[model samples]
Target: MLWLRSIIYYFLTALIALAISAIAGTVWGVAFALCVVSIACLFHIFNLHRLHRWLENPQVDNVPGSFMLWQEVFDQIYAEVRKQKKAKERLAGTLDRFLSAAEALPDGVVILDDNDRIEWCNPASCEHLSLNRKLDMGQPITHLLRYPSLRDYLKQQDFSHPVIIRITRPAEQTLSAQIVPFDSTRKLLLSRDITQLERVQTVHRDFVANVSHELRTPLTVVGGFIETMIDMPSSDAATRETHLQLMYEQTQRMQRLVEDLLTLSKLESGAQVREEEVDIPQLMQLLRTEANGLSQGRHTVEIGRLDRPRLIGNHDELHSALGNLVSNAIRYTPPGGTITIGWEKRDDTACFTCRDTGIGIAPEHIPRLTERFYRVDRGRSRNTGGTGLGLAIVKHILHRHQAQMIITSDLGKGSEFAVKFPQARVIE
Candidate 1:
């Protein structure tokens, strides 16, 4: 419709010029028509120049103003430009949001271009790979990480499995890195700190092996004794009795191991311990009695003053934890060694301390004392009739009670194991 209007207007103007020229001659009419056409073409060329100039440096606030056909054309172009500008703004906002979300992720994220050059990376990626986001952009990822395992993994282009890297500098840490190919040639490098996960897996493997090994020892002994008795049925009564006793002891040892393992499983299964107000003095007295019995008058087992008489926690769990400490004291202490069990209020905290004049532990062994089946002296630990899960159980119980176990020891000197309960759990 706009084009039709424009064409009719031009035709009318040319016809008017010809009618005016008719007063002169045919030659004059043709000349006037040529002049009018020339003027119209020049005006159109001027408008086209304005449009071109505006297009070169277009601004929404500075839209070109024209009349008639040129006006309509400029308005149409401006409207389309505005729509495209809004679309671009929306796309930019979406991109920003995506980048923000990626930045907040705990796992490291690195974006790579088609050439495997670092395009962008999140803060976590910088920390995980020791790459400077500002300085390392456009650098090859392999050059930055420099880990042979990572380089090989990337070079292979087999991203089905993530590669694990153990970083030794600064601090020991483990990272699992994988490459995800996207946009054909581009890639997303994802990395996660798997130190704790790796440690847990290692612990799980050790636990399984230890459990198997522990069970096998007793089973082997029991099986041997049973076979001996079966084959020597005609042997003397005393010999038979000794074999039976040995078999019974082995079975008992196995039972204890199984029970401790079960206890640890229960504790780890997230079952909440029953909370109750336990009489600390009574518990200590019982532990003292048990310690004395275990000691068999070999050590001086003393029950000291209990400053905090009551504690809020699971009685059975507490008993098990404290008993383990006292028993450990008795087991390690030699004859005439002194063992002291007591509770003291230190500020708002209550501490149940067991100090023993035993063959103390090495500093290196103290940190791993609570680990399951971690024995400082394997032979002595076995001879002491420990399931090797006692300290592990103590740790779990104390953790459940919102408490901590603090150990102080020196080689060849006595050791002190203290269970520190928070004020919320202590009733003075």
Candidate 2:
């Protein structure tokens, strides 16, 4: 429409020029027409120059508003420019949000070009792979990782399953890494820290093996004795009685092992701890009697410095914990060795201390004493009728009571196992 209007205006000017020529002299009409055409050309030229400059550094606010038909052209161009600018801003905002989410992830994220060059990575990836964003960008991923297995994993491009790799750059860490094709020219390298998970799995395997190994010996012994009795049924009564006695003892040992395993399991089951007001002095007396019976008068069991403070805890659990300590002292100590059980306040906290003049533990073994089935002398532990889960049970019980166990020992010079209770658990 604007172009049609511009053409019509030019045509009218020509008619006016013709009319002037008919009315006036020919030279005068020609000069007037030339003046009008030049002015019109100059006006269009000025607006065209403004449009060229604005296009060089275009802004919606600075779009040239020209005369007549050119004004319509500028308005359309300005609106289109504004629309494109808004679309660009929206795209930028979406990209920013995606980057922010990737940065906040705990798992590592790395982007790789088709050539396996390092493109971009999150902070977690930097820590996991020991990568410097400014320095390592554009470097080959294989060169930085430097592991044969990982190099093979990338070359294979078989990303159906994640591969576990141990990295030693930053520290000893286990990472589960997988490649995902993100775009036509790039891939996403996702890594997760599975160090703890790997450790847990290893421990689980060990636990199962240990349990089987522990149960195997007794089962074999029981099976052997029964076979022997079955084969020698006509043997003398005394010999038969001895075989039966040995079998009975083996069965008893198996019973003890199964019982201890159950106790340990219960402690670890996250069950609520039983709470009750417990009398410390009375419990100590009961422990003394039990220790004497277990000692069989071979060792001296004495009560020392028994504080009159009552404690707040599970009565039966406390007894079990304290009894295990006393029994351990008795079992490890030789004939005529002294074992002392005491309950007293030290540093404003109630302490249950079992000090013994036994064959003391080595410093290295002390840290692992509470681990299930861990023994300083496996043969001696078996002979002394230990299921090897006593200290482990003690540990769990003390933890439930909000207490800490401190062990101090000198090799061959006896040891002290102490339980310190928090102030909240002690009723003075």
Candidate 3:
């Protein structure tokens, strides 16, 4: 419409020029019309130049202003420019949000270009691959993580399976990495820290093997005693009685093992224990008596002062946990060793501690003491009539009661097993 108006104005100007030429001289009128047309063209050219300059470096405040057709043209171009700027801003915002979400993820994320160059990576990826995010940009992925397995996996583009890499630098860690191809050339490399998962799997395998071995020992003894009784049916009564007694002991051992296994299972299954106010003084007295009975004069069992008399937790579970600790102290302590049971509050935390002058655990073995069937000395553990699940049971019970078992020991000196209940569970 602006162009049509401009064209109409030019036609009218020509008509006026023709009328002037008819009255005055054609040369003067025609020159005047040419001058007017030249001036209009120059004005349009000047506006176009300004628009071009603004397009080269667009700023919101520097939009060109013009008149007539040129004005319309400048306005249209400026509006389109503003629309494009908004679209770009929206796209940038979305990209920022996507990057933020990726950064927040626990798993490592790396983006690679067609050349396998590092385009972007999250913090977790940096830790997993040990890559410097600032310096490693545009560096080849293979250059940073130079493991043969990762290089081969990327080269083959076989993303069907994730590759596990064990890293020894910085720390011993296991990472599972997989690459996914997108947009033909771009790839998303994802990695997860699987160290804990691997440890759990190893523990599972050990538990199964240990269970089989533990069950087999008692079953073998029972089987041997039964065979002896059958073979010596015609022998003297004294021999038969000895065979029967041996068989009963083996059966009892088997029973104890099965019971411990069941208890561990129940605890692991997250079964909630009954909460009751337990008398710590009474509990300690009972444990002292039981410990003395188990010690059979071999160890000096003593019940110390109980600072917190009542505890809000499962009485039975507490009994079992403290009993296991006391029993362990007695079993490991040699003759005339002192074993003390007591409760004390340290900084609002109630602790039920069993300290003994027994043969203390080695530093390295203490970490794995709570594992099922884990024993520092298998022969000694068996001779002591331990099922090897006592500590494990104690650990789970403490967990249920919102408590923790802290074991401190010095090799050949003594060990102290302290069950520290949280402040909330301690009743004064």
Candidate 4:
């Protein structure tokens, strides 16, 4: 329609020129028509120049205006330019949001070009791979990472699994890195910090091994005694009774071990604990009696500084935790040694302290005492009939009750285990 309008306007001009030629002398009328045509051509040329100038630095507000059909031409061009500008803005906004999300992610993200060169990366990516965002842009990834395993991984076309690599750029870290091809020419290099995950896996493996080792000894002893008794069916009653007694002890040890394992599992499961006021003085009396029975009148279990202040926690769990501590003191202390149990307010925290005059722990062993099945002396621990989960159980129970245990010992002198409950948990 616009082209047709332009053609019609030129046709009308021609008709008017012919009309002028017929009315006046051919020479004068022809000259007048040429002059009019020349003026019209100049006006059209000026508008065209304005349109070209506006197009060079196009903006909606500065669109060229014209008097004739050129006005429609300029208006259409302006509308098209405005529509494109809006679309571009929308795309720009989307890109900005995508970058922001990537930046906020904890996992590292790097965009790689076809040449395996870094194009863009988030802060986490820079920290994981030790890459400088400004300096490493367009740098080949292989050169910066410099790990043989990573190089081998990149060489493979398939990325079904991530490559684990240890890096020491900023600190010791284990990174799991994988490449995902998004386009034919570009890829995403993603990385995650698996240091903590790896540690947990290692701990899990060690825990299983320790549990198996601990259970195997008692099982072997029980099996051996059963086999001996079965082979000697004609033996005397006293002999058979001894064999049966040893079997009973081994079975008892296994039972205790299994029970402790179950208790530790429940503590670690983050189950809700039953909360009640724990009468500390009454609980201490119970512990002293249990300790004397375990001691067999060997060590003297005495109560000292028995404060009346109680605690807010699960009574059964507190009893178990405190009982474990007292029993440990009895087992480690020699005959005639005095084990003192105390409940006292030290500053704002209520403390339950058990001090024993026994073969004390070395400084180095104190740090790892709470680890599962960690025994300072394996032979002595076994002879004492310890499950080796007592302290570990104590640690977990204390944690649940928002308490802290402090240990102080001098080698060969004695050790003191003090559990301090938080002020909030203390019922003064």
Provide the overall lDDT of each model, using Cα atoms, as 2-decimal numbers.
0.90, 0.90, 0.89, 0.91
Residue 421 CA error for candidate 2 (Å)? 1.8
lDDT of 3 by residue, 109-209 (tens): 99999999999999999888888999999999998875788888999977999999988877889999999888888999999999999999999999899
RMSD of each: 3.2, 4.2, 3.4, 3.1
> What TM-score would every model get versus the actual structure?
0.87, 0.82, 0.84, 0.88
Give me the runs in candidate 1 sitting further than 4 Å from their true place.
Answer: 1-44, 67-69, 141-145, 157-159
lDDT of 1 by residue, 91-206 (tens): 99999999999999999999999888999999999999889988999999888876899999999989999999999988999999999998888999999999999899999999
Q: In model 3, where is the ten-residue run with the lowest total lDDT?
A: 302-311
Name the weakest run of 10 consecutive residues (lDDT summed) in model 4.
24-33
Q: Determine the backbone clash count of candidate 2.
A: 0
> For residue 238, what is the lDDT in candidate 1?
93
Native-to-model Cα distance after best TM-score fit, residue 399 in candidate 2, in Å: 2.2
Task: Give the lDDT of residue 301 in candidate 2.
Answer: 95
Give the candidate number with the greatest lDDT: 4
